[model samples]
Target: MIHTRALTKDFTVGRGEAVHAVRGVSIDIEPGELVAVLGPNGAGKTTLMRMLTTLISPTSGEATVAGHDIATHPARVRRRIGYVGQGNGAGHTQRVHDELYTQGEIYGLDRRAARTRADELIEALDLGALRERKVSDLSGGQRRRLDVALGLVHAPPLLFLDEPSTGLDPQNRANLWEHILRLRERHGMTVVLTTHYLDEADTMAERVVIVDHGRVIADDTAEALKTKLAGDRLTVGSPDVRTLSRLAEALPGARDLASSGERLELRVSDAPTAAAELLFAARDAGVPVTAVQSHRPTLDDVFLTLTGRSLREESSEVSK
Candidate 1:
């Protein structure tokens, strides 16, 4: 549904120094696929989206979105895809239903068609109660749902969401995701979204693309990336901390060993087998084991493995 090659975007500041917002990023997204783009603040994932959506021109390279060249056929691309940006796209004074209808008309739908689309979206996104309410009066989650409705007013085949669930609480986030998934399934839309929520990206998106310093650092299915880059993690607590650390250090396939208090944690290729071996070795050495637990690798682990930093910490800093 979308393809890019060496897509680059640069900006010049007051001192004439160039800022490389997006540098040589090349990626392909297939139709009917839900892909999540992840990165820290100023990582250029948003820049890449803007270029693809025709909101900004790329400094270099080329892209085709929804079967049209983004550079040469921007209008066609816009017609074929919907974009819901980080900020609410609805006007504050407008009624919820009015906002959706207006957006449809702006996209060239006639009055009747726009109204029909507005009603369809209101029913689909569960905005019936707020149909007459002003956009400003809606809560954060309500406003976000309206924003999604606005983007889908045109019924585009592809949709681009830029952090659609940034500030909502857990329930609202899950609600919004449910609506998004239902809409995608109903319309057969190709979804490409950027999110700071690691768990959301891991569980919701079929594919994950990690961007850093304006480059595409990693791209694969979330599970594949985790399994290939970061294996399972083991957390062990023992009364004999010194002996447990020594034994854990010598375990095969172990990496990133860490210790705190009486607990030690490490990443290994196989956590179940590694934990078993460590427990037996500790038993033979007469080191008492208190507890042992193993966990599957998360998307943040994949980011840390690639960039040597925590994605959660970086995202929190960006929020700050």
Candidate 2:
């Protein structure tokens, strides 16, 4: 449904110092796929999405969104895709239902169809109770839902969501995702979303694309990336740190070993089996292990493994 070849975008600030926001990003997204784009702040995630949505012109390369050239057929691309950006797109003074209906009309829907579609989306996104409320009066989560409804008023085949759930609480986030997943399932729409929530990307996305320094660093299913890049983590606590370290060093599949006082941590391809064997070895060697635990790798682990920086830490730094 979308294809790009070496798509890049550069911007100039004061003194004409160029900022490379997106660099040679080439990726293909198939129809009916839900892909999550993850990165830290200033990682060109928004820049890439803007280019794909034709909201901004790229400095170099080519991209086709929804089968229309983003540069040559921007209007056609806009007509076939819906974009819900990070900020609220609805006007504060407008009522929720009115704004949605107006957007439908702007998309060329007739009066009756526009009203019908507006009502449908209002119900679909759980905005029925707030239909008569002004956009400014709604809470952040409510406003985001209205934005999504406006984007889908035209029933476009593809949807682009840039940090749609960035500021919502856990309940609101779950609610938004429920509505989004339901809408996608009902319409079989292709969804490309960028988010800071690692757990969301790990659990929700069929595929993940990791961006850093305006480049595509990794792309694969969440499980595949975690297995190939991060593996599982094993934390062992022992009074005999030296003995535990020696045993960990001798393990065949262990790597990235670290010792912190009584705690020893390492990455292994199979943590469950490795943990059992390590415990047995510690007992036989009189290492006096105090505790042993295995943890599955998360998306953040994969990002850290690839970039040598924790994604969570990067996100926190960006927020600051």
Candidate 3:
């Protein structure tokens, strides 16, 4: 549903100092695919989304969204896609149902059809409870759901969500995703979202694209990237840190060995085999193994391995 080739965008600030927001980003997304773009502050993720959604034209390269060329057929692209940006659109004092119906009418739906779509969305997004409430009076989660319902008023084939669940609580975030998943399943929708939550992308996205400095650094399934780049972190705790360090150094495929006061941590591809071998070697060398634990790699671990920086830290900066 989406294709891009070397797409790039550059902006000029004060005194013509250029800011390259997106750099040579090439991606292909199949129909009905749920793809998440992962990145930190000023990572060009928003710039890329803007270009794909036809909100901004690229400085270089080409892209087609939903079978329409973004540069030439922007109107068609807009008609075929629904974009729910980070900002809320239903911030006005209009009633929830009226706001949605107006949105449907704005999309060229007839009076009856617009009202019908509005009612359908109210039911689909579980906004029936808030139907009579003014948008300005609804809670953050309720507002977000209303925003989503507005985006789908026309039922576009593709949807672009920019940080759809940024400020919501954990319960609301979970509820939002449940509604989004249901919409996708019901319509076989193609969803492309950019999110700062590592776990959200890890668990929800079928494929992930990691962006940094306006460029895509990694793209793969979350599990595959974790396994290939980060592996598993094995921390063996013992009073004798020296023996733990020695065991880690002698083990095959054990890298990044570090001693933290009394515990030794290392990166290993096979956690089970490495843990077992460490215990056996400790027994032979007269080193007592106090405790053994293996932590499976997360998307943050994969990001740290690739960029040598914590995505969580950068994301916090973005939130600020």
Candidate 4:
């Protein structure tokens, strides 16, 4: 339900130097699709989302979101889509249900309709207990759920979420994801989100677009990006050093062969075959294998394969 061409955004701070925050990121997202934009800090993922959501004007290029031109028909685009930003959108002093009701009214609903929508969302997001509490009193996860409810007040068919679970712990992140998925199922909404969590992007999103340096680097399913862009990893750990040495020699073309204490890890094109060959070779060499495991490459591995850098490490470095 979204299309863009050479979507670029530039910024100028107090000085004269220009910052190319988003550059030529052309992408298409289909209806009823869950697509995650994966990137590290300063990677332009958020810039791209802001442009599509019409929060900021693009310096160059064009985009159509939910059947309306983002540049010319920003109001139309906003009417058809919901947006949940990284920060809390609710006012601190407003009551939880009151916040949602006011948002619904702002979206053009009458008092009765707004109240109905607010109550429905409060129940759907499991905020019944916190309905009477002030927005400031809710936990981080509760506040985020309220944000999602606010976005859906108009019942838009498309939704945009920027780092929806950024600061939440593992359990709360999962809870938010569950609510998002359920809401999509109930409304048949198309979801487009930007996230730094590699595993969440891999497991939750049907499609993944990897961005770096304000450019589109990769776009594909999580499995395709992992298997085709990256590769499977094979690791064998044995107490007998002779066994690992023999297996390493037997595998002629294995890459990234490393010794971690009693373990040997290899980045290979085909992990199962390599693991089998290692087992056979170890047997022939009279070396008993203590542990053998093969792993499918993760989304982080895909990012590393495409950009020669780790997204987790890059984000950590930027945070520091």
Which lDDT tens digits does candidate 3 get at residues 132-161?
Answer: 888889889999999999889988999999
- Note the Cα lDDT for every prediction shown: 0.93, 0.93, 0.93, 0.90
The reply for model 4, stretches above 4 Å from the true place, is: 238-253, 260-262, 285-290
lDDT of 1 by residue, 39-149 (tens): 887899898999999999999999999999999999999988999999999999999988888898899999999999999999999999999999999999999999999
On TM-score, the stronger of 3 and 4 is 3
Q: Looking at model 3, how many pairs of residues clash?
A: 0
- Between candidates 2 and 4, which one is better according to lDDT? 2
Winner on TM-score (2 vs 3): 2
Looking at model 1, the pairs that clash are none
Off by over 4 Å in 3: none
Off by over 4 Å in 2: none
Candidates ranked by TM-score: 2, 3, 1, 4
Clashing pairs in 2: none
lDDT per residue for candidate 2 within 1-320, as digits (tens), equals 99999999999999999999999999999999999999988999999999999999999999999999999999999999999999999999999999998999999999999999999999999888998999999999999999999889988899999999998999999999999999999999999999988999998899999999999999999999999999999999988888888888777689999999999999999999888888888889988988999999999999998989999998888788
lDDT (tens digit, per residue) of candidate 4 on 1-320: 99999999999977878999999878889899999999998899888999899999999999999999999999999889999998999999999999999999889999999999999999999999999999989999999999999999998999999999998989999999999999899889999999998989999999999999999899999988887887888878888765576567667457767777888887877888888888888888788888889999998888998889999898888768
In candidate 3, which residue pairs get closer than 3 Å at backbone N, Cα or C atoms, i.e. clash? none
